[model samples]
Target: MWLMWIYRILILNHEISMASIEPIILGLEGTAHTAGVAVIKGREVIVNESATYFPPQGGIHPREAAIFLAKEFPILIDKVFKRLPFKIDKIDGIAFSQGPGLGPCLRTTATVARAISLRLNIPLLGVNHCIAHVELGRTVTPVDDPLVLYVSGGNTQLITFLNGRYRVLGETLDIAIGNALDTLGREMNLPHPGGPHIEKQAQSGNKLLTLPYTIKGMSFSFSGMVTAAKKLLHDHSIPDVCYSFQEYTFAILAEATERALSCTKKPSVLLTGGVAANAHLQTIIQKVAQEQDTSFQAVPRNLAGDNGVMIAFAGTHLFNTGKILSVEDSQVKPRWRTDQVQVGWIE
Candidate 1:
């Protein structure tokens, strides 16, 4: 009878220990051309894997990209599971990028997330893609509260956290900075993603040609600059045009960021998103941070781009804060703005 009592005690302790373990979340990202999957145990990222679809000729065709994500997501998810120390059933919740992204791509990812959540009988979290970027930047960097400069193919905004949500102080009035770069890249016959190539050519460019500098209040427009830069290509070398393009655009961004920092008095400035990979942008923003007497941080190149890890981290926050959603309510938002999300976990 004493042996039986000891066995029961041991079993009870094991159950309690299991219950005390931190929750694990699986995240999926398929907002555009990239399909990603990652696993996070509490705040630690266990595995992150992704595959990007490159258009054969021009920009991403939404349907084609969706098909690619549909095919690649399973493979990436399997890869993540293989690298994980625990089994698939051990996942406590599922999180996915809900929006704002291509409709087909968002649907594909949401379907996968729903399937996983239902199969495992776990909570489902629909995370905002833009908020995920900011959250991940905060998690990996030393910044507590920051003035965020979010730049990417589809978005360009100067954001700050206030009250219960991220507020946009400034944003692009026309095309996003990354899209403008890619458009210019298409004009130059460069690859689909034009930012890196433009940066490369800008290194050798000596001439700073004329380009429109549009800044109305806190918002800026890149479409005019892009058009003018394209026109300059006929009379100037690619390198010179690229150089002038970076100088003008990055300067505009730095100016806006500085203004926001000064106005908000944020202790730090964080640069994040796909365009955050540009060294020139980083340099310019760093300078602005120094001038404002605030610390500066840029998302690491690997995490700067869209990935599943950010989504997972954001999802973990949502799950911990009781933000789980039912499958029926987990719908995609193609035009979800940055300020639309209620950032309940920040406070």
Candidate 2:
């Protein structure tokens, strides 16, 4: 009991000190198709701008997306500076998404971050992309400690903070939920970022065709569902397939989330990442939270998808904790896992 009391006191002190000082940080995020730049003075986002690359056909091509990000980053940075009332030199640090992303994209963004860090003679902080999503969700919402449902294009996991780290309680065994949706969308001749398109079609769909619902313990798999959905195209209506795809996949996610919540018993549940913007998934997870009698909040639509603001916010926390990185040591990790990062900024 004494140890717990001391820990709470330390956390309170940290919060107070952080609230007293507002440091300016410039953050860059180019993990995949989006190239984003933003500046933040503490929690207030000064300017956040991003450009997404949409292939003419098919999913993201790493080389092509890297080229697109490299081209747009300068413009986005310029836009951010122009929108700021103060000079760019006021920034105290530069933060970039270090990894768990495509190699080319991560390198492109890291190069820009390093250049700016050296140019300004400021500290550089490498942030984990997955942790940034959870931090961003926490920043924009009222939930202090919550079970995080991070669903995106390349990754899906249920995360919660414990032992000074974000622990993964559950994750996808095969392709991520977003990837499955996009793949099915492509097979249907839909445009890129199939989540929105699928959601639209699913609204008109009254029937739910059977699709694979693979969940073992806390982990789930979407590969089977994607394959089955594609074959269902031959005999089933597009709306029905889309609706069924969402129902089965989202139900699997909701069940897993609920199970983790039951075990962790976090105060709330946070639905983040690009796929979190889907209303159907939000509804399903919200219902789960309701049944558990816990609060639920989804990241705002503006911050739901990948953005530089998340990097800046999380970077600010890391910077305050003195987790600076040297240019020579700022190498990107394509397979960096969330559990590998120590949450020094948090308890």
Candidate 3:
């Protein structure tokens, strides 16, 4: 009887200690080309690990990408737990990128996340991928309630927190800007991943080639611009085409983002996602945001791309606001829309 009472007292004290400690969340990111794992306690990310796979040629094959993610995710899982840096297990939740991504990759990631959640018997959260990018920017920067510009390989949009959701004021009607850039890189046969090469070669560009620029209201189209730029290869130099391509695309995106700023009446502008890391695009958006008298925030280079940190950070907020998902309800949302998710995390 004495030993049992002692054990009960110790267990109760341990629970009280955990209650005094800030909660933590482990996030799984398997949205597209990257498979990542992150651990965050409160607002700080203590572990952010990821592995990326870029195809040797052409666009990403969904099944192949999914296979690669499946292989790498287990490795990442091992590394994350091995390097936790602490013994505290206050892992209050498990969050995963639940939608708006390649179907195969999304499913693969969700499967792993569900296994972890079930094994731990904790609440799970299904987070929107694009919204994760935006939240990560806000978390790592000094901006609050900014007009968010998210540009990644699979997405492009201008969003802001308004009313009760992340409102999309503008977006790509055709191809995402990052996709367009990578496609142009492929056409030139410069490299498998062409974004940086395009930027480097564009530095020597002395002239701008005339390219198609399509915009309808707040939405823009990059397919026509990419096609037009590709056609210029025979007539114009690669450097010139690349320069003009960046110029035209950046201009249109800047225009749309500018429109969102005015309409949203936001106090700051934050840029995030993989394509937001481009030096040229950063320059363009920074100038635009400053011109409008709104502060601009660029997510740190490391956190800008698709990573698990964003998922965990966003998930923590959602979990605190009473969001929970059962095992059966934790399915992947391959085409989940950002605006469709009820934003209970942010005020």
RMSD of each: 2.1, 6.8, 2.9
Q: 107-136 in candidate 3: lDDT tens per residue?
A: 999999898888878789888999999888
The models' CA-based lDDT, in order, is: 0.92, 0.93, 0.87
Better candidate by lDDT, 1 or 3: 1
User: Candidate 3 versus the native: TM-score?
Assistant: 0.93
Score candidate 3 by lDDT: 0.87
- Full candidate order by TM-score, most accurate first: 1, 2, 3
Model 2's alpha-carbon lDDT is 0.93
Clashing pairs in 3: none
- Clashing residue pairs in candidate 2 are none
> Model 2, 219-304: lDDT tens per residue?
99999889988998999899999989999999999999999999998989999999999988998999999999999999998888
Segments in model 3 whose C-alpha atoms lie over 4 Å from true places: 1-21
TM per prediction:
0.95, 0.94, 0.93
lDDT of 3 at 258: 88
Write the candidate numbers in order of decreasing lDDT. Answer: 2, 1, 3
TM-score of structure candidate 1: 0.95
Better of 2 and 3 by lDDT: 2
lDDT of 3 at 133: 93
